[model samples]
Target chain A: MTTSPIADALRLPAGPVDLTAIETDAKPGFDGKKADGKGALFAMGDELADLQERLWAQRTVGSERRVLLVLQGMDTSGKGGVLRHTIGLVDPQGVRITSFKAPTDEERAHDFLWRIDKGLPPAGYIGVFDRSHYEDVLIARVHDLAEPAEIHRRYGAINDFEARLADSGVAIIKCMLHVGADEQKSRLAARLDNPDKHWKYNPGDLDERASWPAYREAYEIALERTNTDVAPWYVVPADKKWFRNLAVAQLLLDTLRELDPQWPVADFDVEAEKKRLAEESPVQ
Target chain B: MTTSPIADALRLPAGPVDLTAIETDAKPGFDGKKADGKGALFAMGDELADLQERLWAQRTVGSERRVLLVLQGMDTSGKGGVLRHTIGLVDPQGVRITSFKAPTDEERAHDFLWRIDKGLPPAGYIGVFDRSHYEDVLIARVHDLAEPAEIHRRYGAINDFEARLADSGVAIIKCMLHVGADEQKSRLAARLDNPDKHWKYNPGDLDERASWPAYREAYEIALERTNTDVAPWYVVPADKKWFRNLAVAQLLLDTLRELDPQWPVADFDVEAEKKRLAEESPVQ
Candidate 1:
């Protein structure tokens, strides 16, 4: 069966998705969902594994092209799930994941990019950032972490920072995992109720929930200002975890396929090396 | 079955290991083979995963404690395999991986720790470094990446740096994956002969192989000097990939088990929250 437009847009394989399109008072107004595509999702997962291995093999040649996947989202928006499921499918050797947290005393002493610049993946490697530099715009704006005037400058600084990264041969894929406030509340409450998940509950989460509208506005501004072609942000409907994973994986594959990397051929004598191996073996 | 003492020391699971002990004219060595008590090796891996999950759960409560695992070894040492297998066992939500490469112009402008400090795992998280600050003492000392005088200073700098990290509540685990030169040659030759593996063969690797004695000397000095009580270095026999994975995992598990973190109980009025959920139900 052919995939529908929404399926293709979400990068889900040919299958049904159990989802509902809902409207919110937020500026974007609505989000769409498809039926569950678990089968195709797992199949695409396998394909992602193969693609990752191929990319890893290419990396062995020490090429100078890099890939960076940045994940931005509200709490409980499935960013962690997407990262876990997708990276699970790649060769760990060629993949690196960096999760940015609140700045420490030493980190605050330097410019914001100081920490980010060091975490860039090496050439021919895949780097995933869970909550990246956009925090400067989102949290800083919402929580008033920085002066209001300084926050305005950070918007421009972030745009230039990402533009420079894109120009430097890094294919940047920024994903904004979008989940409704109600969905987030459900997930957060679930964590509180479950004994095994009790560790994942915090009073501060409720406080953040109180400022959801403000954070949403901040997110919109951040996306509009910094979403350039080089590192455009894809606002993903993340209420459906499976679909989100499939979408991000497809995006990664589409990007890597565009690179069309080849396994560099060996210049040395393979036969001689094999012969040497045989000579050293007792079986001979 | 109970594990053997050496197997226990190496942290191998209950399985056959392809043990090979090597002895040069000056020194004797061992190879990969089945050993008794290998199960103990896996104990650490399990402990690490438990610790990681606890840390991840703590993030919701805003408790930050960073855990850094640093793996260093010679070529053909099982660093890749250990990383792949151990990380696979952890909850990806709370973990990040950073692989250090040759510094770019921007990175070179800062202190050696600058790049690494940026990649530190956020509090309540685990970070794995494929190769780490030890590169200053290993590669820099081996290839003269920095001046001779600078190399000596870096060793002390690294010690002080790691101590500072420990003081700041970052538990550090440093492992040296050990493999003999002969085994390295064998693995390198294997990569050269297999067309599927040809991409992994770098001609420059041969040059590094030629400097095996120097690298070994540098590593020995590094292990002797920088390994402290806060961050002791374990010389793991990495000729066997399975044993290496099991041992590293066990070490991580042991360290994490010691922390024994518990999930924070939510203090919110659960009955009120449940009432709210009911009141907010769509049917209502």
Candidate 2:
């Protein structure tokens, strides 16, 4: 469902995904100044909305195709920004957003992917994962939450899980929002400065921030190991949030456009129905 | 989902859907001749399409509400007509239609409701069944497809099945499209006369048509036994196909309006998202 647009440059090449080689403030596609970019973003939003409505309409009559946008980013890497700015353009009813948090007691009891299976968008939906199954490999690897042997096992499991979803009409678009350490610090400082944002500025985010190098190393390994043909990975630069939002929007719009779902053919006899309606209806 | 509009007159009273007592030609809610009724039908269509899109949108954002429209009638009772005219008014993407045929080996392997379970629409969807579980009682009784004892057991099973569906945010609207024998005979003759409609004119339909009285008795027994508060049956007079379409559309529209789902609140920190976007986004 993905097209080889310029946005594909944002994707990590197969094998090892070198974090240092990828720019955290890249703006390859957007040529305009911020004002023009924002205008373009709004225009993209309208197109995304129309495309999403068409997707919903196609699915309503029984198309089984779907799209999933998997977003993985560190604290203040603009995952939420992309959500609010890009995915938010589409109607919420056609969008399924799952913000994976600390596992609940019931979720903890099941396998890591169990909750993911439950959260998948049904056929003909656009699903956004704020933080997803990638957490199992990323956080778990950085913190040594699982055994080394088990972590490697999960990589294969993740690939298989994504493949199964893809086989069942899910077009997976995985994104890693790349941010420089300096950019992260500035965003964190801004959060602390704003009193209203105190609610969002979780103290634990600082704890995770402390493990930054480990987390980035973990992400490189994840992107390399789980970067798939069925579920391709895109590395969006997060230092410039506008660029990040635009790239993500363009990426999604490109995929949806490629899907190009149509209105379903009428399942009933159209001519007979028209004739019946004409005969029965007393319209002049 | 059955509203107490003037259309309520079309519904068989709670006791029994007495096929004999009910007049098939009655157009209770439709006041005008064919012309006015057609105008009203188009108005209802516009309203239905809008409401259905809203429903699809609401469900996309994680609502578990849905509607299951179970349609049944003797052959040529305008089930296909309703699909083309009324349900067609709604976008195909939001509607899931199931035309249940004779149970497959896999379906028959499980209990009767297994196929139904596989076909129930997900939340935020409108599911239409051209012929549904009612056939378990109606056809199985008249044609001796299942045992008399098993036929009685199925009624209880069906009640339990619909109750489970209703409890899980599905609004069930079952309609028995009632057509008088003479009306059916004329419609069948017209189908024979029209070469274009030959695709719809099944030779097996004539075989079923021959056992009309037996099917009527079986339907009478089935309707009386299974009508519950959770999934009530609305016996729509189908001799006037226009009235049938309008009544069904009105019923579905009224149900969706009653559900009246609102757009979901943002799950993210809105003000914080706005702030971050303002700071990081170079846009004025």
Candidate 3:
């Protein structure tokens, strides 16, 4: 039951990833329509909260294990929406979200992974990267921010880095939200249509949209290059926002269930403590 | 309608404050029972989400305003419960929650406020401190960690620090979750009884419980000394967990409604961008 078909279907296969071949609007593993999808997600909330607490409780037993969710997508791919609707289901205290914008000068001065290393979740926490070190490859390759050799080297470096994280007990979930060009245009236009959404629209999103083809190729290159067993990639069909949220959430749920974090046993003498409370700590 | 009677009723008045005089189980500003209280909190979710987004959107327009909610209380006073139930209502992205534990060597090396300054929310965010700078006075006083004069000086230092934060547009909400000693005994007993909750129990909590009177005196003195116009303290009767959650959520809602953040106006031409998107960026 922990095995989600969505995870199996949406997971990028070992050989190559073609951004064009996947139908952007297709609901890959879900059988029903929108309402059912939402209801299914809603039903998972209690279990999600339970599993997250168990994961968080592991820290008390000196477990360093944590989950880092890396979300990468083109503009208007609904990363924020997923964060609010999906990750928002759990207690915010147990979740740490870091949204990476353009690197600050201090960040640029360090290795691309340095800032990311700093943002990693602590023991018993779920760390989310809205955009992450993958940017070092995706945007770096697209904008030619680094030399060709350096850009080429980042792929290996990322793999090695994630491998170390895996060894040290980090469950990495990498998602590439795959929205079609038409979908992107409409989402951007909707930002223009609504005053409440204008804050989310950036003119630079247009620049990124114009280079959609390049970005797709860059993603394909990055995804194919760094798709390791430790941190595999999921190409969520982002044209449908609900499906994107549900898939990511289901992916997280599946992972948590697999981890199967158990509540830590009491280190103290529970019976003795209970006795002490009864005797020494009477109602005041 | 924007104002909450809960905020006004819970807010500690300007004068000598007495923790013992307050009833820990009484529901102030709320006439309903637990189910109705939970219903009221659930009803506030949409407004909370909307207001949080407005506050978050302010960052787009270069607004520096943010709100900081500092929760301080004895063990099992339900600070964690409030965080899970109340602050959990809004988008976690817009919130920055810091749980202040015993100071590290590095944290202790720096001025007390240095670590606190580092934890402050960035512009346009709601920052929550499960335990905060007030620990300097409360714990320092109880354990005699600092000189008598040094502890006295910290009150002024904290007031000045908050005044500066207020001047820079940080609306501060400090809540002291006042749970009675008898209720705390039962809660501690419950933690000892449940294996699932054992991770949350620390044997040291019993030691702290033994020093309850000292801690209460410390809180009383700390509240009296540092409570200011810039950052007032609200004594939330936390014996009823539902009321505690609802009251704090309402306080946040009241503050957000007062700020009444508007969605940022787009700096770019909406019509022109729509045209460019439609013409240049067609479906692939």
Candidate 4:
């Protein structure tokens, strides 16, 4: 798929961003590839692997740098694809992933952050939240998880929560996988049409579709309120799955590269240890 | 680095076997090749990328296949190396890792299973526990997490808990990294000798060393009690880092391949979607 040159040039806001501008500027069909035919997925994969290694090493050496990746998106927005591709590049030990479903009674008993806090990555670990704390502001606001006034309050609370986590040495990267309405409808239809994927289809998704404008408005407001310098949101173009993954992976790699942890030297004498092993052998 | 031919030819048991016999009989060294020969470190970098992709795919489809990787070991058993290598092969999106640290007040409040249950992988996810529920039996019996009688109960509970999770479709792979006492002493000494790693050196670890025979007894009991057909434990040789990683990775990949989830197909009309995209593009 091809995106317009103008749309292609649009850079996602790095820190606090104007939600209206972000929404408007984020064209749905923006092609991740230019005429060069180079897709971002492969590049991102390579970089992600490198970053994961560096991060894993840091953890091994007792450096407590934690990273929280928040992925928020509309249906068919390539969240899954991006997640799949990005994780493909990292060490499994240093990473954790959590996907939030409807709030169970136990979850609803606690404040919104309760379940989330439990899922946070340990020091020097990476935690990926498929849908995260932002759900309070997004779905809750749309479905009335709270009063409108309370929803407004959640925005600030979430911002503070993420900022505090960032201040405590956690790197937060929030990606809003942006897709077009047409794309969402088609993808939703695909779910309905396929026998194997029927499990993923929900009648309520279409009900939400009728209120797309409201959800979009809620998303814009949430983005406006929560986007911070310490914990920023990236409005990634998600029409292309490969590009989305590549972009997120690159972003992750770039962030870790900035951390720049050094590999610690192994303290053992290799030759001496080998000799000791040989001497200890019964046959030897 | 290579094992004797006689040792290589020996057949090992697939079920519960003596660690000493396996160590003596099996070929030494990891069969898994590093992605690149910057030693294990560089190979780890490459493997992370591959893992990320697989994880992302799992997450995208919302598949319920969860991976529970258990890393168990004695002190200085190269658990760190195994972790480094394993993490090097996964994507952060669908992967979650929890290292069982010393218990806290909150942990003590719950049954041994509670803390572990909180860390269990969601459907279509991968979860790694550095030291796991088995600790209830291993350390509990070794250091006495409970009374000797209570330890017996916990053993059954641990086994049942794992059996239930496996029945619920969790693919559990447990590795008991084996290292010689002399090798361990050398590693512990290395930690003390290196100023940078001094923080990791606890004098208490030496106290544990004094009770090595007791701990081994505890390990034997724990293995006998908990090694069910569903969650079989592999007593991995840890002296050779490369061989250990290869064995573990192969086991994991083989398990995942066995599950064999089909990739989500593109359900839209590819030609139409492409043509629509092209027609909509001004430049195209």
Deviation in angstroms for B177 in model 3? 0.4
In model 4, which regions exceed 4 Å deviation? A1-65, A109-114, A143-146, A185-203, A257-284, B1-17, B24-67, B76-94, B109-114, B122-124, B140-157, B160-172, B181-214, B253-284
Tens digits of per-residue lDDT for model 4, A41-100: 454455565566566556756777877888898876876666555664566665667778
Top candidate, metric lDDT: 3
Candidate 1 lDDT over A220-279, as tens digits, reads 778777767677666677777767776777678777776667667776667765556545
Q: List where candidate 2 sits over 4 angstroms from the true fold.
A: A1-284, B1-4, B275-284
- Tell me, by DockQ, which candidate is best: 3
What docking grade does candidate 3 earn? medium
Backbone clashes, candidate 1: 42
Residue A84 in candidate 4, Cα distance off native in Å: 1.9
Expressed as tens digits, the lDDT of each residue in A4-122 for candidate 3 is: 98998898998788889998898898998899999988988999999999999999799999999999999888899999999999999999999998999999999999999999999
- Give the better candidate number (3 or 4) by TM-score: 3
Whole-structure CA lDDT of model 4: 0.65
CAPRI docking class of candidate 2: incorrect
Model 3 spans > 4 angstroms off: A281-284, B281-283
Q: In what order do the candidates fall by DockQ, top score first?
A: 3, 1, 4, 2
Q: Looking at model 1 chain B, report the run of 10 residues with the lowest lDDT sum.
A: B21-30
Candidate 2 similarity to native, TM-score: 0.53
